[model samples]
Target: MTDTAPQPIDLDALPEEDDHDEALTTFRARVGAFELHWSVDAPLSVVMTSSSHVGRAGVGLIEVLTSAEQRGRTSQAYWRSAVGERLRVQGSHITSDGGAERAVIVQTDAVSGLEVRSTVTAPRGTTALRIESVVRNAGREPVVLTAVSSATIGIGRSSSDLDRVTWGSAASEWLAEDRWRETPVRELLPDISLPFHGQDGRGHAGVTSHGAWSSGEHLPCGYLVRGDGEALAWQIETSAGWHADLSQTRNGGVLSLLGPTDLEHQFAHELLPGESFTAVPVAIAASAEARDGVIAGLTRYRRWLRRDVAGEALPVVYNDFMNTLMGQPTTEQLLPLIRGAAAAGAEVFCIDAGWFADPAIGDWWSTVGEWREATARFGEGGLRRVIDEIHRQGMSSGLWLEPEVVGVDSPAAARLPDEAFFQRFGRRVQEDRRYHLDFRHPAVRGHLDATVDHLVEEYGIRYLKLDYNINPGAGTERNATTAGDGLLAHTRAFQDWLVRVQQRHPSLRIENCSSGAMRADYALLSVTHLQSTSDQQDFLLYPPIAASAPASILPEQCGNWAYPSSEMSDDETAFTLVTGLSGRLYLSGFLEELRPAQRDRVAEAVALHKALRGELADATPFWPLGLPAWDAPTVCLGLRTGSGDLLFVWDRDAAPAAFTLPDVSGEVEVLFPAAPTDGSGWRLATTVAGLSVATSAGLGARVLKVRRG
Candidate 1:
């Protein structure tokens, strides 16, 4: 503890010897906006504390639990492990480049021979940092790692007031995705009276995601907020399995993050000598601006993570799947839609699913994987004619592809080797009516590689909606140590394949869609150009998903569907169109069959999104009405831009009312449905405190442009 501000010092530079062997030697370093202080004493730890506020700083830097060794903690929580406490710090240093500062700390458990090289990178002008660790089996014998930490840090208000903090988490599903809830930390981890008993609490609060959907059931992101306007946000970047926990550590609250664990996901890695395993990446952000500001910081961190992958122009895409073709697109059905999409201002027309199946047979779910045109369904030039028609209309062509699965009835099932499929207990992994392919296998990779190449070269396709519809449970144990380790390696290998595909065809745009937003994590979005935010068809349910998606996904990458039909009222069409306008507009439905007014509305929405999308690329998303709840009558999402702010408001059965929006002022105007009678009805005025928005009730949404004066 120092009275004056601490200065940068060597992390391993121990202080003068003290009489007590357990005496702590404190080291301090400024990493971006965070002032990290660590103790190079017996149990190595790091904490974010500075002159303004002191947070929980005594967290064990890393934790590794193995099958043979004793469980780290007496409780089931993955913290305070014997290995974590015993691991001695080896070396550490800091490096700066590209407006970010990075710190590398290496440690090893001499008995277990596990060497963990942990890195923390903070982007300039942001109060957040990205943390990840690579563990290597430095010993002579193999070790079955049951659980390894990707990020282990302490978070909360001052140590004494930690229990007062509240945390927000997400519950995701196929149709109902991005349902967020905020609860007090005490509600999950109550008061165990650690000081009275002199022991850390046994019970813990946490979130875990299993199977292939990195964001299924629960998103791999959450936030902790203190009453003092201080906040900490975190996201585990993985497309496979992930786990995060919040537990008491006597130092306040410890947030432990891991990829997969034997205790939870049947994931155990048997690391051989010299072989290394890099855990999934996790980003942690801190802010004095409360929950929204912390999320804005994470948005910045995500951009920093995608430094190599450039942001693409947000194109209005028309897919013939939702509420339209329903995945059974025939040449007769798609030709008119392609022409319609082009006329309605869609830059890309996608034929979603059923392109290679015969509808006569019905429910072709069990006969996919062979990416070929079904000759009988399409007339004349077949699928190519539809694609050519799209090109002739001055729009790019896109196709739906589920490259990860092979159906039981498909010819590809017999063509690929058994080694190419996920093997568990000597049998290929089957879920629903399909078998999951092991991308690590050359045979499997080659098959998909050729399929993509054909689509890009022969078909002249510019966009691809790569959809993943099934989860193969635990992972393949074919060529790996344990099932969990295999799953982790398999996902990582798939990322490599995506990189190769993008490198081969740099101009092509690949969309990341996993049964909707199930797999919308940074692991895939970092490489892919766009993310399908959800599969929810009801426009009423979509506002929450689109408004809340930016907490873990970038606003520019959120491909929220805007499917409008001829039957919908003008107001209803505007409602759905505004959802798409909130992020990257994904168009669909029967645009060609719509009345002139309805069709004109869709075109106008596309034109508006195109004009304002440049602001979306660098904008920071905040929820003026708080993170959208599934049943919230009114939901609001605000994106802070350089010139001003763009506010997206949704009203679903809420009384015609007004709620104050935060940090927005100056002149305001309705951007979409520009004319009052065109469809939208809204009022916006800059209040003395901030901005006031009024709207009509019953399923109406509006996008307002706010210019700060």
Candidate 2:
């Protein structure tokens, strides 16, 4: 909390430089409770180790393997031995932002003529450190980089306390998403024997994503928890593929993070004499208090990273997609929905898919280009009337667009050149009749630009739902050294295009969706506005996904759909609305068919959401009943916002519902629904453990607003 204002710290002025213990050179700094230490092999820069959350004693706990590969050898970064060559430190320095933010820079050069600059930064008021590495070609000849480390952290050697490390990661899919599991490290590397083995560990455990959809396969984030529950959590922020591996080192364990590598991602890029490439940024946060503490650090960092891009207050968005029309919408179907959405207090009314689908075609997926209004489906001037109606109802008009895909049966498939599409082995890459567009091509950009411009200018649209459905594996090898390199290049190009589009239309809001939560990568989320939490049609099964979304995405930006139908019971309607009110409220379903009571419930939920929206912007998430299990009958998610804390609880099986929340001395009030349904009331009492609540409304949910006593 010094008034230093981010000035450079002199690296040579430190008192301990001349007074080194043995051959290891130590550089240390205090960033809150976290102590960051970096060590160098005095004369040779071959071994530079960096560790964070170091205790008061400040011993070397983490180790990073810095040995250079043999000349022209295709050795992967984490899977190689540190015996061939060594790297020499070129320069080192530190800087501070005058607050709690500080950064340490270490520059090194390899004998193979490769220059690497690694920077580690700890932002203001957080226990997390962000690391990024830039590798440049310093030689006269072309050098191929197969694997490069983004950031690495080491924990313990052979300590029994560390041996019980448990790792956790999330598994995702189209409907079932955010399924997290924690297991012992021994189970991950069972074959690797323990005790006295060289300086490095026997094996490693990690999760890797291989395509543009970073979270499609496995979330690029995880945690390592000791037996006592003290944990260190980390996340890799990349739109393309990424890898994070944890392996036991001589006296500890090392967690190494990298973008796309040759082994897992088929990534290899050639660097010309003066060419340079920067690895994706990764962050590791620590918590001594509890597991939730680790999540809090990451949550703060996620908000900090989005400070620049997350513009304005997020409002309730009603998209007529999942569970509602299901892509079959017309002028007749949308007019009533638009009015109903506005009446339900939606800030934005988005007409989902089938707007451009040919009326004659039975399947709309194949004919998904041109981005034009389907006049046949919506009588003459039908679509325009519905859009104007939405605007007249005091709501912003929105549209859903799958811009990255070109259906094989669409006219644009024949219009755009083959070079504009992803190619492998000189042939176009098509998955399920859809060709992926390579943003590196100008034609692809031009098409999407014109589409967006027309949608915004002609229709007066203010919001857009940008969705990607298919994954074309790695990437196109056309005009690139490797498929992964091309994919990464294209991914960056697409992000750049999004930036330009946003610049052109500063007021326009874009929602990032990938058939659900697949492509919820920071590379896209950082630039976009809202993220679709999941596409789970079963409202009962969506609590876990909605509750855990804050772990990966910001709460205000998590667009959890609440599609309540007339067929649902009163409790079911309230349950669904609670899910929406808990997050951004991506509203949907047949609102026109609902009873007056149901409509009032929906309207009240939207009102509660609007009231909570401002507080949600600064809220930090907490799990009252632990991280929700996918099939848990009782689940609760709490958010501590500026005004107060709000706890959302859902009872699925209609059993006796009781929840013990975290310690919060206060008077709790039901903020949503305006009135209790079925004349049932909630029982609230304070206990030694925490705030305990019991509810008589079976199979229902509620958002309780806390007023601190």
Whole-model lDDT per candidate:
0.82, 0.75
Model 1: per-residue Cα lDDT over 1-709, one tens digit each = 1123334354344333322343335555567766555555543455554313323445676788888874566887888877777776677777788678877778788988988887877788777888788889999999888888877776643345667688889999999889899999888877766777777777788989978888988999998888887888889888888998988745477788888988779988788899898888888888888899889999998887787885377788889999898888898888889888888888999889999997786899999989998887886788888888999999999999999899999999999999988989999999998999888999988999999999999889989999999989988898887777788888988999999998898878889988998888889988998899988889888999999998889999999999998889888999999999999999988888898988888989998988888888999998877898788888888998997889888888746877777666788988877667556566667878788877776568888888777
Best by the lDDT measure:
1
Deviation (Å) of 118 in candidate 2: 2.2
Off by over 4 Å in 2: 1-25, 29-85, 98-106, 190-194, 662-665, 675-679
The per-residue C-alpha lDDT of model 2 at residue 373 equals: 91
As for model 2, its CA RMSD to the true structure in angstroms is 4.1
User: Which residue pairs show backbone clashes in model 1?
Assistant: 72-81, 267-484
lDDT of 2 by residue, 441-460 (tens): 99999999999999999999
For candidate 1, the 10 contiguous residues with the lowest summed lDDT are 14-23
In model 1, what is the error at residue 389, expressed in angstroms? Answer: 1.1
